[model samples]
Target: MAGRIIQVYGLWVWVAFAFFIFVLFNQSHSPLPHSSGKPSTVKERMMRAEKAWETSVTLRHEMANKHPGYPRIPLFPAQTLEAFGKYPYTIWDFFPPVYTCPHDIQRVGRLGDGGKWVCGMSLYENRPALPASKAGKRTKPGTVIYSFGVNGDSSFEAEMLARVPSAEIFAYDYTVASLGPQIAGPDSSRAYFKQVQLDRMDVLDRTPPFMSLQTLMKNNSHTYIDILKIDIEGAEYYSFDSFMDWCDRENAGEMPIGQIMIELHLTDDENLNFNRLLKWWERLEKFGMRPTWLEVNLLAVTLNPNKADPRCVEYVLVNHKDRKNIMRQES
Candidate 1:
């Protein structure tokens, strides 16, 4: 009887061991918990890559908001965040850039301090070769470039026109009567200039006439801007404030700019407080502008010997929402 009981227990133990082995084998062959059980095709790989990119962008945004650079003295007090009760300060290197370009970038201006760092020369280069039959026919209008603060340098404008002669270039600067000799000679017809200051329409006691971006776009009948370059001294704060209000009121949620290359001047003034700077930057980001490139203005450093941090910084930002439309036209 004891032998019979022992044999029954041994048979049960052997059956349990076989079941465990089967379960382990199935687990080893099963898809990972985080992966879909689909064949890896080109489309699937691309989808996975896109998902990874989105995840990385979200992570970087969170990191930027959560961990700011080592705390420093605030640039402005809290009272200046809003203006005229309607416009508010949008908030910045305390604000790290989170945008990147995957295309081949090149410098588009003079080799010295006047040139701009541009991403993807597709707008100026890589035009589909014109067939022999259509070699002379005028192609569609090239990119539209609006540059503010042509203080006396037109190297950028000249090079752009040389590359794409059909391009429409408009420059504005209240300080200068005309563009530099590069574009101001007999060949200046390729570029247009206006002695206007980029400012709010309501500001009073302004000697030179000023116009907001919205007003200029309307007057010029420009529905889109391929590139908008601004180096308006330190007026960006107020200029952007007015522009943001106009955006909120007129264009719904989209900005009409494709790319922005600006030289931001941070002076030791109450207007450029740290909080205000961050708010201004945040506002631009809210409109889908992402900085793909940034460089400390070496000229600013060389010129301003007293300040530890130079007053000027250069930023090249792409408007993700509107760039595709402009890029499609260029292509």
Candidate 2:
């Protein structure tokens, strides 16, 4: 009887140890979405961000230093463990704090697959920062957006342009044969679409109309950008480097871009390309940026069918120190 009791106690201890390990692993590695406000503590995010970066590098490490990082947190208190186990799409049950801002994360369409969200930013920086004017073709201050990728699902761009009527968006996508913006709303004039690669120029165009971010800004007579969103398949990683190089050469220091929303694409062959992404995130940090929001694309699972893939995550970053630069530069 004594031996049997001891055996049972040992088994219980092992089970407890295993459960603890499981929790630790998920919190450390689970790619979680972000809510509003800043992360609670700095040290916590420093650790969480690093660990999170290791396994899956779909992140935007821009100007998120204000709030500490939240790791693969069991954010939803509403859903019980039993509820999560019972459903397939119950992954949304791990709810993070919902952010309300300049405009809420409005879903434009569920067209092909995945949810489309845009015009959504942190309320802290959601004011009408973009200067508007009564005079026609005003030159002093302007709000411009540069979108890099456009498949059929550019509803995110169209919706955002509609929300802020004063802002103009320049979208780039070499894959699309169409050369003009296809916005179907009142603010259609503010949006322009181009069939060019955001990453390359020499091959696509004769003069390369919209070759680089620097050239695009110069051509448009702008020094600072209000918002930049990139989803150019796998080229975002390279274009980001080119953009940084341009900033370093032109501005003498960091380029003041207000916000960035990028979708990172990892090759099916390579899971976590750490060294490259590590350096990329580090460069963004130098420019006073941090990751504000991150969400996984559950819709992507149906497309690829690879359970271990980490390609369809959208990351939002805030550039905290850009307003001054925009005000100081010649536009």
Candidate 1 local lDDT, 225-279, one digit each (tens): 8788899888988888888888888888788888889989887566566556766
Q: Identify the runs in model 1 with alpha carbons over 4 angstroms from their true place.
A: 1-92, 127-141, 184-187, 202-207, 327-331
Error of 2 at 264 (Å): 0.6
Tens-digit lDDT string for candidate 2 (3-36)? 9999999999999999999999989998787787
Colliding residue pairs in candidate 2: 38-67, 39-67, 39-68, 62-289, 62-290, 63-289, 63-290, 64-290
Poorest stretch of ten by lDDT in candidate 1: 83-92
Model 1 collision count: 13
C-alpha lDDT (0 to 100) for residue 161 of candidate 2: 61
